[model samples]
Target: MEFWRYYRVIRRRRWLILLGTLAAVLMVVYWNYTTPTMYIGKTTLMEPKGQTQDGVPLFQSQMMGTMLDPQLQLSNLGNIATSQKVLSNAAQSLAELGLKMDPEDILAATSVHPERDTNILAIEVTLPDEQEAKVAADAIATEFKKTYDELNNQALKDSRNFIEGQINSTRNAMVKAQDALRRYKEQNGVVEINQQLADSVQNLYLAQTNANQAQINHEAAASRAMKAATELAKLPESQIAGTSISRNPIWERLSESLTDLETKKAAMLNGVPGQPRRGPNHPEVVALQAQINDVKDQLSKTKSDYIASTQQAKNPVWQTAYGNWFQAKVEDVATGAQAAAAENVIKKMKSEMSQLPAKEAELAKLQVDLKAATDTYSLMKSKLDEAKIRENQGSSEVALRTIDPAHVTEAHNNGLLKLALALVLAPLMGIGVAFLLHYTDNTVKTAADAEKLLGLPVLTAIPGSKAHSLPRQHCPEIMDVAYQMLTSNLWVATQNQADNGIVMVSAEPDAGRSVNASNLAVALAREGAKVILVDADLRKPTQHLIFGVDNKVGLTNVLSGGATLEDALALTRVQGLLLIPAGPVPDNPVKLLRSPEMKEFVDQVKEFADFVVFDTPAGVTFPDPVLVASQVGSAVVVHSAGRVPRGSEAELRQRLESIGVRLIGAVLNKVRREDSSSFFHYHRSYEGVVMPQLTSGKKAIKSGPRDQA
Candidate 1:
């Protein structure tokens, strides 16, 4: 999370990140040098106008308007342009132009797009060469137009044929209707008969009315005649023969003369009787009787004459009831004959009326059939004419126009941009990998790593070297300078402590604790401080070997009371410095170090020496360093870079702090000079000449003649 922490991770794993970044950059560069370039050509086309001159549909354009869906037109055109048929034609055309190409290849290289919101198509072709791209684009467009025209012409021809078939069917229907009308007229024997039919119906009705009236009159006359005959039959035959007697004038005159004669006779007879009864035939009586007889005879003759005259008259009125009956009989016979004649007329008229309905219905049906056929025929003829006109005027060529001809252009390349991106990304990828390695690697590789893990200040980074020879074979100044800084930092860090005893320890063995302690003690003595370096690692003592001193009588002998304190101390090669080795590898070194004698030894050593630096065993796996740490005035942990585990360093610091050990600070040993990245690296080059190798019981002075104090 912090900037220095990230920097340390990168610095420690610099080789790993560098190697990975270089590999990625090299791969990108290799790819940038090996691919080919292409060229492009493009063309544009516009759809044909929908109308013609006079703004009316011409050459079946109306049909086209109804059938051609505008939404699908653009898509259809695009598909046709890139189709196999178009491509094949284009390939043939190119071959003729002396530049052969595969149809499939041409199709693969061609692309068509229908421009939105406009009746335009944009066609593009890509090829290895500019001229080839231009040629391919133009050829494809020309072939597509030709194919569209062929398909359109075929469609028009099919439409015309269909219309012709419809016209023929209408003509047949017209002929059938005409024939049916002619047959109906011939069968019924009538042509235009509406007026005649109306006249016949009116005449039949009039005849029926006349016959009905005549029959009524005849029936009345027959009834009167029958009544008269019945009355005459009831009368006598003599009364029937004397029917005209009352209307005779001769008879009336004769009867009047007789009546006058009879009256005169009656008067004469009455006068004679009153005068005297006369004898049998008195004159007056005789004259009256003779007059009455003459008058009676005359009246009879007159009656006979009147009756004969009435009966003999030809056109006389009927005077007798029997005579009237005879006249009524003649009327009844004549009227009955008239009634039969009227009935015959009615039958004839009804027969004529029945024939009229059939004739009128047939005529009406024929008229309707004729009209339907005639109208249908006329319509078909009009449409046939229109079809013919359109066919004659139709154009065989398609209406596509080239708005922009094909042209060539350079294709775009983005290799440089891609190369730049690869360059930038390589280092980032490498840094990410470095961080991963840092997290996975748990060893302490820097003072920051140790400090962060242990929660302690790193006193100094003792610059390390690859050489493994003795101190006499190399310069000790780098080590001496680092130890001198360590010595100063420790004094200041523990100035408040009650004692001047210092113990050096690490979390684990092989962490350079003995080396750092011996160097620090020698450096302190060189500064005019009387420093006693004790090898408190009774289990694995290296101090005696490092200082070239005998380890026969050391800290163990002093603690066990096998030797005196002054006898156990061995003088080191450095002035003002003393060395005490482990007297022997005791069976129980921890018990010997924990004894009261060990505590007394520590007190007495601190009293005699200005600085007592105890080189204890690694405190992590062994408890010797922690035991000694508690007894000493101050404790300092020494960690070797890239050797001590970060976890162990943390544990060691916690244990010491828990036990109340006065932990001053930690020293980062074996730090590479190149990675110091601080002011320490600047001073590392000033390491003086090597120190002279120390011999047995011999005190070695500073090699370069530096002052002791």
Candidate 2:
């Protein structure tokens, strides 16, 4: 239901939505056509495998390896491709090619990125001219490669220089070590130093054997002392000599009570040997058992309070163990002293051995220093050679490779995407506007709105006509049915009332007040009742034109005494229906309608016709309708659907009610097809059935025609 309501709103404002959408689409198309075309040039590069021609690693250092990693290298290359240095060089190159481009412009046009999950970099340049784009892409790539190579080569040069310095330092150190060794040998007269050192080592080994024996004996004595100490710890410090136990008289009395209770319980249960053995359930047995438990608890408490005494004495076994422990500890101390003396002797022997040959020890140390320097010089020399080789071979060619040269291609204009977006957004924007207008529109569009505003039921909703050129009889059957329904509702509302006059009024002009009034009169006349439609709107009358009658003299004439009500009445095409045009424009319709003569005119019309519908101008703007309604004693408000301003109907209704006029409900006039109820859809089924036109022999009344009903 909600969707249908929104659909009706869109349908009512379809032309507005269409125009807005078309304008948006045209704008998008014009923008796309007027936009300049752009050309793109792209270049591709790949990371080097970091392998030398001789199947050796080119970058051996941790830093070098990181700099050459595939992912990291590709990322660095991407940055370099768009760097200021590369872009400036590219701009200069472009200037040479007759394209005076700025570095900023080139930078703005250029984009560099690494391909996902691949050791590849893509550099793109977009420009209006194809040749410029291609040249710029190529220049940036070439410059980036050169810059990268220069960085790598500089690193290699630094490494080579460092290695060369180490080599020089190591050579000097090696020479010094050789000379020091020769001097040490000469000064000490140390010949066959290894043989002399071996003799001194043999003597040191014998002394060490004696020290080991002393250490073993000390360890054995310490173990014995530990065992004796453990046994001593297990012995008691003091021994009990004798002990005595004493019982409490209270405990003895409780025990005797418990025995007596148990004896009585047994007698109660055995029942004197065989007379009658009582069961355990006997009350006497239960009582005796509880007494026994009480006595037992008391005895247990008394036992805990009993006293005990003892006499302490020395333990012979403990004394013997203590003596043994002391003797072992004394022996352990003596052994420890002997082990210390042995250790001291070994230290003295080691000191004597250390003094064997200082020149031999110094010569050995100098020889070790010379061997280390020689090895270091050899390693640095090899590294320096490798660095020089790496520097000679260009770093760029070994570290990076060009996968694809820059080439020209047409850049994507995204015309289709823009067109699609415009197409999609245009309707959405239009719909949004439609809803905005819908919510902002303060008018009655449906019967519900009228009823809600007027606080009264809606009589009927008259479907609007699109063919103004056609005659009224040729109108669609739906409109006729609507008028009939209105007439029926009005009859039911006013059937029991004394007054037969109804003043038709509207809040705004062009609300089809006159048309509704004429149609209602026709509907009532068709029901076999006399009907009179009075165009009381003296300022602007339309009933004459609606019924094809002359408006030379009407209600105004009758009220002004220019003619009687009978003389002013004009016959219409509808049977049993008479029309009274509003006649000449009045200077003051309000004063005339409020006069007593107007009240007399309404009473006369009520007596002449079964129903009298007085057509009036906009009640909200003019007091003519309200004045007429006061004399007529009843009012029927007619409002154009979706055209009456908010609160206008309510104000008009309040005016009528304030004058003590009976509100006969409202009629939603000029309702569009979309706003009509579903019940009205049956008109489509009757579209093929042509409605018969009712014709009367009586001709239309011209000027001065009187109808004496």
Candidate 3:
């Protein structure tokens, strides 16, 4: 059902959608015809695998080869091929071929990319002329090759120069180191330091041994001298050889005289015992002692001159001890002098040994420096030789080979794709616009719309009439059923009201208000009720035309007191139905409808029929309908689908209710069948059953109503 409702909206605007799609297709066709045809020229090149153009290995090790990325190399080559220098050269080459172009233009027309999973590169150029495209491709490829070769040669030259510089620097360092070592050796006298150090160690050992031996010998000699001296001291210089006694006569006489003098001196000193005693200190005693001392001296002189007795023989043991002592002392002095001389030699040897290590260390350091410089110079010389070889070859590590020359072909066209896109998208755009207009359109298009807008129940949805140019009498059976439903719903709504009369009003003109009033009266009369449809719209009367009644004098005439109710009333062909036309348009319908006679006319009509439906003009245009509805006391809005704006209907309902007119409901007229809800499907189902009964009932009503009238 939802889809059907949308279908109805599209169906109504189908012509608009068709026109939009056609316009889009025409535009696409024009664009496709006017667009220029393009041609493409292509060329192919291959990158060398891990070697130079001269077949020299690019990498020295397998690890380096594995780390090499083909993609990264391709990217670098692509950048170089498209660089400014290459492009400028290519442009100049193109000019030589009679095609003047700028570098930017050539760049814009060219594309370079590497083929996937391969070492192949593709270069393409696109232009309007096939020959021009081919020429441009060739020029670009030639220039790129020349530039790449030049760059490779220049790189090789730079590598060779660098290696040469390193070799020269290393040679200089080696020479300096050699000179420094020679100077150091000459300054320190460090010729064969290892051998010299060994010799010094041996000599120091011999000197130490000699010093120790001499010291021992000196101590032994000194001990022997001490023993000899002790023995010599104990033995005297000469032993007492023999004891001798001899006396001279003169010595004996002198001894006797000396003894007599001594006896006289003693007597004088003691004083004679018998003669007068004399003091020893007396003169006579002193003189006598002096004479005795003189005599004793004379006796000693005589004893000395006269020898006593002597033995003259040397001691052999004493003489031997003295000689041994003298020999030991001389040996001790000689040993001591030898020990001192040996000590001086050991000290000199030790001093020389201690200095040998420092000289050895210095010599070792200078030798190490010279060896390092020589090794470095050798390595650099080898590298320089290799660089010179590479420079002579004059090629880069990654080489290029032309696989295919430039060739031209037609470029792919997308005209059909554009047409297909237009076909698909044009309809979508039209649909979007249709929905936009549908949603923005404020008019009531369905029964639900009418009900929701007016806040009233929808009485019925009348199918659009097939013969809208004809009278209501020629309308289809579906319309008749719709009117019947409206009458029944209105009847139920007004059953408890004091007045059974209702005013039929619309928000706008051409809403089928008069037609709905006429049909509703006919449907009510067919149900065996007396019905009267009064054309209260004096401003724009449509009921007379719908019912084909005379309208010379009707509601306006009665309201203006120009005609009587009996004179204005006319019978319709519908059984039990009556008509009162608008009865000539009045200049001022509002004043007439607002008069006191309008109420009386309404009361008299209510008493004469079961229902009195008053058809009024559009409420939004004139106040005539509001005035009439105010008198009728009840109203039913008749709205053509998508004809009357919702706001107008709401305003009309407000006006009627404000004037005390009860709004029964609204009728959604002229609704398309597809827009109707599922409830209307029952009408289609029971069409066969209801059509016969309706025909027979109409026959009965026509016959019976004619006889009674």
Return the TM-score for each candidate structure: 0.52, 0.60, 0.56
Model 3, range 1-709, lDDT digits (tens) per residue?
6787788778767888899999999999998998788999999988777554221222222112122367877887899889999999998888887999999998999999888888888999999999999989888888888887776676466556655776787689789989998999778775565765555555654565566556645765676678779988888676666666666777787778878877676555433322333577888778888887887787767753433556656656677667667766777898899989988986675566556567664565556456656766776677667767776654644446789999999998789999999999999999888888887675667888777767889899988865642235465667667776887787778778778888888877988887777777777777777777788877767777777788887877888889887778777777677788888888887788888888778777787777888888888788888888888888888878865342566667777877787888888888876677633575558654646433223322123333455
Summarize candidate 2's per-residue lDDT along 364-406 as a digit string, tens digits: 4455456655665675577668767766774644566889999
Steric clashes per prediction: 2, 0, 0
Q: Using lDDT as the measure, what is the rank order of every candidate, best first?
A: 3, 2, 1
Scored by lDDT, model 2 comes in at: 0.73
Instruction: Encode model 1's per-residue lDDT on 1-709: one tens digit a residue.
Output: 3775677677767887788778877776676666556788899998774623211122222222223455468888898998889988999999998879988898788888888878899999988788889988899989987887666555355545655675687578678878987898788776565777656645654554455445544554565567667766666553233244444676576677777876555444422211322333777668767877876776666654334333333222223555556555665677678768877975775565566567674565455445555565665566567756655555422457899999888777677777777768877888888888777665667778777756779998887765422322343456556666787897787677778898999877877888888778876777777778888998888888876778899888888889877777776656778777888889998898888898888888787777888988887588888889888857888888875242556667767888898778888888865446653445555445455633333233222222222
Screening candidate 2 with a backbone cut-off below 3 angstroms (N, C-alpha, C), the clashing residue pairs are none
Clashing pairs in 1: 243-319, 243-320
Clashing pairs in 3: none
Tell me the lDDT of model 1 at 335.
64
lDDT (Cα) of model 3: 0.74
Stretches of candidate 2 above 4 Å error? 6-10, 16-39, 49-76, 103-109, 127-129, 150-394, 397-399, 410-442, 468-474, 526-528, 545-552, 678-683, 693-709
* Candidate 3 residue runs with Cα over 4 Å from true position: 1-38, 49-69, 72-111, 143-399, 414-443, 464-466, 469-477, 494-498, 508-510, 518-531, 544-552, 570-578, 583-587, 643-646, 678-709
